[model samples]
Target: MNENQQSMPPETPQTAAAPEAAAAVSVVALPWYRRPLFWGILLFLGLLLLAGWLFWKEWQQAEATKASVAAQTEQWREHNAALESFMQQLRALLAKDPCEVKQGLGRITSPAGVMWPPLASGADRSDAVPQKPGDLADKSGSGRSDTPPAPAQNNADAQKQIPPVPVQKQTPRNVSELMEQATVLVLAMKEEGLAMGTGFFVAPGYVVTNAHVVGDATEAVVVNKAMGRPFAATVRLVAHDNGQDFALLGVDGTSGIVPLKLAQSVSRTERVSAWGFPGAVTNDDPKFAALLKGDEAAAPEVVYTEGVVSVILERNPPLIVHTATVSQGNSGGPLINEKGDVVGINTFIKLDDASYRQSSLAIVCSSLAAFLRGAGVSITMAQASESAGGKQ
Candidate 1:
């Protein structure tokens, strides 16, 4: 029995050692890197690190590309804005005409003297009935023959002596209609800026304005208030009388404006209006681009002031004084009566003070008539001869 117990104890010790042998065998079976779970975890950690690095690089590259595109877009916008501004300046330069500017007036002078007539009320205010366009039947009828007349030397001579009447005489229109038709804007460039003034059609292709308004320019430009392209003009005739402060200018082309009829006389109580480009409304030198900023600018316009004749002066050539408001640019405008007849040329203003208190003066019809006659312009006023007789 003692031997059997000893043998069983030995078997118990072997059983305990067997578990340690198995553990050692398992540890020695694979190295740390060769184990299946160890290798799988290492590979997964490596892949995660690689993916994080790639994502960070892609994010940095995208940020750089976005910054470069933004810089290029801003530069292109600046270049486009600069190109548009240059085009506007080029268009304004091309619109100016070469013949619009002139150098001198060359050998033009005023008449010896003008007549200063006493005030007279001879202007006819009767409404002018419209005349039809046709040849008037000859009251004499002496040249008529039943048979056809042969072309002869005597007939040609007789026909030359007697001139045929035109189809239509001047059709007189209302003063309001004439104002819209005849008024013109005169512009002349000087050292300071453009000298703007008022003028009107006196004949088909002729205009009358002030001497100072025209200055010594040989060419002037006329723009109608009725909205048309400016007409380039040559100063065909210029008559200046310092005493009268008047000038007669003949434009190159007919403005197609209705001419106002000249009145032989103007009464002291006549209601009148002075039409012109007053300095109050017109700028001597306007800066359009700067003044308007980015907004579009429009063309300048004229102004009119209404008043009445207060007194007629007793000077050498009588001046018609009025209460019509006048300004620096109103020098060459016409003093038109209620009937729309041109009585005088607006010349100068006498200021009571530096304030708005002022009295305006215009050259009377007698002086204007004398000036027109000296220039060989024949006017058909019913009482022009009688008005001249009063001046003497």
Candidate 2:
């Protein structure tokens, strides 16, 4: 009993203390929920889960936006297609019956007497006109007013010293003479090349021609019959009346040109002359073709032919039918009566048969007068016509 007591001499409370301490150490070494490393791992896992959820949400929104844009694009394409189809239908309807007037053929006959309308002033048959700058000098002061002298010229010596007013006689004697001076060959150039037609001077620095003659051309050139020098011209304005074509051109450098006067009256079955450079004459004659091709120095002269008024076709726009021969290049030539006055514009010809027996047609003076008045151009002659308000 003494030897057992010596071996357990220090075992009062220490034996239980050492076992409790060991148990406490072992529990601390094992991982717990409150430990720093364990908490770090848990936080990392939570962050990963949160990132995955956000990525899924963004992908869903992107898919929705892409689908919306695709739907709108499809709708616009369908709308454009529908509009294009509608336009094609409208164009097809306008293709038929394009012209306003449907002209007709009349019986061909040769009348004896020319039908002429009376003048607006029957007693005023005189052809007196204002003097031009280049007219022959006249010493008579008949044109000026014979008023009493002013204060400065009250003396008899002042009256004798006053010079007489000189008159100018620049008017041409006949239409044949006017053609040599004022007729011009109009040439229009475009992407397709050169197009040829005829024109005549109506006023100083102004020429009248057909609109079809200057087709698709912004500008044109006029070649004189004498010098053949090309004068630059601008297409100022164009007017078409129920298929009656007219164009007003503003020309440059018309110093000595004597323009033809417009006739206030036109008579049916009257003797008239058509003057132009006809393509029929040019295509057939080698000399004229050479002149056009610039192979010859001599310019082509104006071609004149006489004929009687055949028939007056009254339609939406009235036309004059004459036996005067004309062709393609004579589109804008002048139709002058025997009184040296412009009565009409040579425009078109109707083909009668397969041989193309064509009838010469012209826009009458009445239609021309109305057009010029509407265009605000002042004419020296009166715009008097029996058929003034007849048609377009």
Q: For each candidate in turn, give its C-alpha RMSD to the true structure in angstroms.
A: 19.0, 21.0
Model 2's alpha-carbon lDDT is 0.62
Clashing pairs in 2: 136-169
Off by over 4 Å in 2: 1-173, 283-297, 354-356, 382-392
Which candidate leads in TM-score? 2
Quote each prediction's TM-score.
0.49, 0.52
Report lDDT per candidate.
Answer: 0.57, 0.62
TM-score for candidate 2: 0.52
Error of 2 at 380 (Å): 2.8
Q: Write the per-residue lDDT of candidate 2 for residues 190-225, one digit (tens) a residue.
A: 333355678988877778888767755667766655
Off by over 4 Å in 1: 1-173, 284-301, 354-356, 380-392
